[model samples]
Target: MKMKKFLAVISAALLVISTLSACSMSGSVEVETEFKVEEVTEKEGTTTVAGKTFVVKTNDGSGLNLRSGAGTEYDVITTIADGHTVQIINQQGSWANVTYGTYTGWVNMDYLNETTTVAPIVETTAPSGATSSPENPDTQSGGYLYSYAGFNPAEITINDSSWNLTLLNRHYTLPEGYVPQLSEAVRGSGVYLDYRVAPHYQEMYDAALQDGITLTPNSGYRSYQTQKTNFENKINYYVSQGYDRVTATQNASRVVLLPGTSEHNAGFAMDIGWVTEDFENSPAFAWLMENAQDYGFILRYPESEDKQAITEIIYEPWHWRYVGVDAAKEIKASGQVLEEYLGVR
Candidate 1:
């Protein structure tokens, strides 16, 4: 399944590169060197050419992509908005290395306008000496905007698109009807993860197995109703212990999420090992803590007061969550919870 997805994505990207490379770059050079372009389609916002400056000219709502390499197959650095000026670094076939703010990546030359000078971005200060408001986050100092899709707290909600890197925590809850894809996590565990997360989980499990570690997926996605019942049952037990119903509910919530709030419903969080503190002493837990980030998984709750302060959850060494590989690497290196890394906390 992963191979098919990989092939499909790669094949489509290769097609785009093939088409682009076939296009001619024969426009008259305004500078000493000739950069490829069959014709200058738009001349209005062009700043500089001949490998010095090029303006993005997608000419539509869809912006041009700046990629890691000179091909569509490379990862996108960011999207270059139409008419936005850029500083060039180098040029390869059908692509040019360009600088967009702090980002440096390759962009398709077909969607560029050649120019003679790099235009300055004029920062507009607030009129009447009024301070900037939330209505325009860009007006704040050190707030130059880029097209990178950063973390969004709104995606943590029940109606969120599951494909997003949603931060599931106490504040975010899954919808009652939110049943994401489920696939068997292992051969015999009968456990399953969200289809979006299953492959990465499998990859991590396999790697851990190779290292003689028994990293198990004890639990995965749970239905909202199931979590609600579990919370209620825990609440009932606490109430039977001579606590008031409200107090019991609150105590119950400390351990179990009140239904939709459980990260299990998100299908990315999983309980591994034996679900005990002793698991932290196991070689499996040690291996996972060190290597899971390679597979896009992170120990969701570590035994750290600082992390617990931000996550508002007790340390659970057995709990792991799947963010993306990039985010996971950053989180592991920084030792921050999902909330802090995402700027949500």
Candidate 2:
């Protein structure tokens, strides 16, 4: 009987060992199977376009302007800045069709670069001792560090806000570091316009669009330094045409404004669509003539005014300036230049 009991105890010991081994194997498999290794493939936060990625690169403050069509003449949709990612749907000679956030437009190919992968821009806290507007620090604040920044007349009033009616011309200049409340009219035009004037321009643009007319603001805000560069380029072009230096300088001044004196520096002026005399004959011009004043703007220089005697600048239908609505109406009624309306001339 004692021998029988010993054999039975051995049998139980063998069964216990076998059960423990099976449990260990099952545990091992569970641990190994539960952990998964995933592959890191695409760049994080990068936009995918046409199965390829392109990044925006703009060193100048001028953000890449996205247009309804391929050319500058097309309606501006928005402006995008450096480090932004876009997907290119199609490419023409100099423009690329792209879509960003439910808006699609053409961007200048010169500003786009194909890249392996890139992430969207992340905002960092402002540095010490610098306060930026909570609204649009990039546009409204001064210290535009780059050449693409816009300027506001330094002496613009706070007591009786000029509301974009302030006069700036050859006789006046915006003070250095005068910053206007700027907002982008489109996503990527990088045109930091006066906050007050941008809305009016858009309303006018929309109004014109309803009538099948397209009026695009090709040039809006310009820094004094930019104006200087344009002025010098104009002088150089005239000199290349065999004009004497003195004659070229004077001629350049008549057309290309002296750097400090251009109305463009004020951020209130806009050069729309075209710069040639032929612009006056377009349907858009006729529309502007009959209706622009209602939107609080005036043709800064009209062909009817004696260019030499009245404004000293050549007549240009493309240039328009913002005055207040009431003032614009009166000026339109009286047929006076801003100089005559304000009695500055």
Candidate 3:
């Protein structure tokens, strides 16, 4: 009986050891299975969360314009070269918010082709003459800085005879011999303007007269030749003041636009009261600032430094452009310069 009990106890001990070993093996398998599943899940999440990459594809090779806003009507932040890679951040209609090098802005998705290959991160510095600040950073709507380097006006010439909304600036100019139909801006004032602008100017002049202000049209409707003479005279005046030819020309551009670049050449802009800064102090300017938008006129060059940077022109309180009543009101309400409103700068 003692021998049988010993054998039975040995058998029970073996059974207990086997059961514990099985449980330990099962736990080990479960832990290994869970780690494999977690590793796979993490790898999948990383791929899924990463932004898709794209390459710029342009047929003209002029590069794609990265804009401050989603549409072409928005200000262009920079130009991305063809075949450059960008990572899309978001999409709106046909536009995609993208990051190229150190720059971030919106680009047309139609010009981008999806790429599975990831681009290596590259840091870049802003172009010389670009304005940047810590608060504004360097490459976005709130921070992107525009420089006047390497700009060729001939590349952006506009030949269209759009009386109201045609853009003329250092970056954009009228074609040679471009002219508009003209009439007197104010009866007997001898200042001519585009026929579309004359009626509005007459109404604005009449309204100002009702308010006891004489809103005289001092200058308007300059032909290309007239604009050229005016620009040369300005350059000569600056040269007489001891400036080099290059510097004088630059300085002259701030006051008198270069030939076809002047709004006066387009026959839709008018200079009222005086063309100097003293015009800002006059009641005529104040009245125009308050009521000109109602008659489809807007102060062309504003006094803001940002606006000056965009326009590349000095503040001119007396200069006004006719953009139709709706556009005038919108531009005034937005407090943006014509370049920003029209998105051509």
Candidate 4:
């Protein structure tokens, strides 16, 4: 009876060991299977399986513009070069917006491929400060860090609260640090504008002379002290004319500026008072309008009520500011105010 019990115990022990071994094997198999599935899923997610790049394939020329957005009225950021590469940025109906540089604009889907893809990270920052132009910064005097930045006859920088743009002959380029300080300056005084708008303004001066209109740049850059005096004088004049602070300040802002808000502070823009009177209605104005684009200048305040209101200043028809040849030509051809031409408005 004792021998039988011992053999039965041994058999039970063997069965227990076998059951444990089977469970361990099953667990290992499950772990391997799960790992394989996850690996496959991860591979599928990152796989570059379906995309392709399409070159400009047609000889039939068409008018195409790279808009700031998907619509026609949106700003035209840049025109795509014939051989330039564009990564398809998905499609909305018949149009596909592709990104080039810091701008995203629409292109016809027929000209691109649905299967093509480009994973370019688009930068939406404007061309200023940290987001400087693509060309080498050292190559040309492009940055706003020169000895003179943001000085106008008027003292305040003409930019609004946003400081994104300024009012000059055209769109004056104010970089990050050269923004206007308004709240601090009292409104009764003329507003000064400090912005480096020179490179563009100089181009216009040269262009005007080319057209037999000797536009003398009477004032190019002015010191802050000079702007302060100009503002105070305007305020005093207005106060003497029976105008209150608000009215006097507004009127002063038209032709003068509160110290520190003037464009003269930038040392770029200038007041080009003609040798003779009737400069705006003279040949000088006509010549500037005709040939300023070739030399890179634009009459800052266009003679339109709507545009003048946008500029928040009276039309100084003689004042032409330079923006650069490419931008100037675009502005002149468009016949739109600087704000409109720049699409800032």
Candidate 5:
């Protein structure tokens, strides 16, 4: 039975490979083959392959384990330390086979970067302006906003037509039986809640009201198909406007969560700000800063000089994510990014 199961798994893998045989990059055909259980014979001397680099923001204890092949450890090299540069000879799975001098080994490809040097960490001398988390008192937790490592890509949903997982940007309609009630004073108020944050968004609205700030919802749910079209539309619009693919992708990436990688998919994130510059700068924004966590929300992105660590494509003062009141309050008081407050790191 074990042999039969193994063969079946192998067959399924082969079928997937055959289906993807046409996919290639840079004139090189990428063959989809079954995950081979066999070991790769290590070649003596050294060989080089093209790759990219990235700097390490934190120390992941798993030392670069030198493997002769994928998933097989022949040796462990200890000399390589955090913040050291490595030349990647090849990439397999999530591990990058890297070489530095005589040492050749595998490192978690997640931490590797095309840039080796990270900007030095600067301590904020000013008193923290944000709410504090009750979860941990030693330090504020806003560090998650500073590092992409805090992001859990696995939580992101990527479906054929819809993605409803964490960290996904999706299109949805307000669930049946859901209706938003506007306070009489807030009606005709220019401020609108991005519908991407909907019925689940009431918690935030109520919390803001408690602080004497009347916020309104503008946009909410979007379908996956809508996201796909929006993505292509942005690509076309940017290219039409003379923006290259890279810049356009970057610009679009900020506002439009790549179909499968948006937090808006959770139906728990909203963008809020005042009706005018004066309103935006007024006590409403300040109230959000002081009390948003009470409603299970956190400011998604905050301004910082260090841009390399935070992967946020765009900066928005109004965007907030719901993580439940307890977590939100803890995160707010802790002063950590949602990613860190969630312990994604």
Candidate 6:
């Protein structure tokens, strides 16, 4: 009886040892189980991770776009209205993965303001000296003002349609939902421009063709969202080349203007032929240098250090802007950029 009791005790000790060995062999089981739980929660349109609340703040009052992925190339899930709050789950560079109501997506962190509590709306009358009227509303008293100060985004909202020479750099932006009356600049080529610019561009194209040079319109009339996608793509390209998010954005802006600040977004610009410096050496460019102003077009970005300083844009030989025959002639004669001719610089 004593021997049998000792054998039973030894068997129990061996069973405990085997259980520990099994656990050691599958050490990641607990971690895998926990990860699966989080994945299930995410699939259910909820997150188990703790998050902080942030409010959407934008200059144009257009709110912010929530995307399926962290980049603008991703599909838009929805547009979160300005002043709406979102829960930030994680951050990747300048983008934040967030949840707003039942939807979860990513948004540009630049447009978010952190707050522990929602701020109350305040009402106040305009200042005593401020003057606004139907004839000259406050937003359109004159042409939208452009600033020379560097790299400010969406400072002014353009409302006046008569302001064809309206300056749109980083400082001035079009109103939200603003889309100009558009027509195909080159029929069947799929390029479009504002109605006011189409006839002039067609005339210019015909004239170039008469001179045995074909000026092909490659791009024109980009929507605000399209511009955003383009800008973000350029930024991504730079980031892929070892640039950090901040530097990537800065570099991208030099080539692709921020969403609302682009002339393409305004529908008053066109990119012709090859969009490269090599266009500067083309016969088509030489023809344009001599006669584009006659048809109300001007080389929007010229190769001059002084102009680049004021315009804050690199020389793009193929980009042209339509600014009426008179304005174009004056600009060409004065050897000045649009900013300088308009006395804005």
Models 1 onward score TM values of 0.53, 0.53, 0.55, 0.42, 0.41, 0.57
Q: What root-mean-square deviation over C-alphas does model 1 reach?
A: 25.2
Q: List the residue pairs that clash in candidate 6.
A: none
In angstroms, give how far residue 209 of model 6 lies from its true place.
1.2
Q: Candidate 3: which stretches are off by over 4 Å?
A: 1-151, 155-162
lDDT of each: 0.65, 0.65, 0.71, 0.48, 0.46, 0.72
> Cα miss at 191, model 2 (Å)?
3.5
Candidate 2 segments whose C-alpha is farther than 4 A from its true place:
1-160, 186-190, 305-308
| Candidate 4 accuracy as TM-score | 0.42
lDDT of 3 by residue, 141-241 (tens): 42112112122464244344644787888767777688888999999977889888899999999999999999988678877766765555554444444
Name the 10 consecutive residues with the lowest summed lDDT in model 1.
143-152
RMSD of 2: 18.2
Clashes of each: 7, 11, 0, 45, 31, 0
Q: How many backbone clashes does candidate 1 have?
A: 7
lDDT of 3: 0.71
Task: Report the lDDT of model 5 for residue 263.
Answer: 48
Best by TM-score: 6
Question: Model 6, 1-345: lDDT tens per residue?
Answer: 999999998997898678767887988344222212234323332333226678889999977987868898986645676877877656776787765542356899899988796332111122343222232222332343211112445556555665579888866777647788899997786778988899889999988898899988867887887777666665454444455544555656676787788889888998886554667998999999999999999999888898888887888998999888999999999999988887884
Candidate 4: lDDT over CA atoms?
0.48
User: What's the lDDT for residue 10 in model 1?
Assistant: 100
* Overall local distance difference test of candidate 5: 0.46
Alpha-carbon runs more than 4 Å astray in model 6? 1-151, 155-161
Better of 4 and 5 by lDDT: 4
Best by lDDT: 6
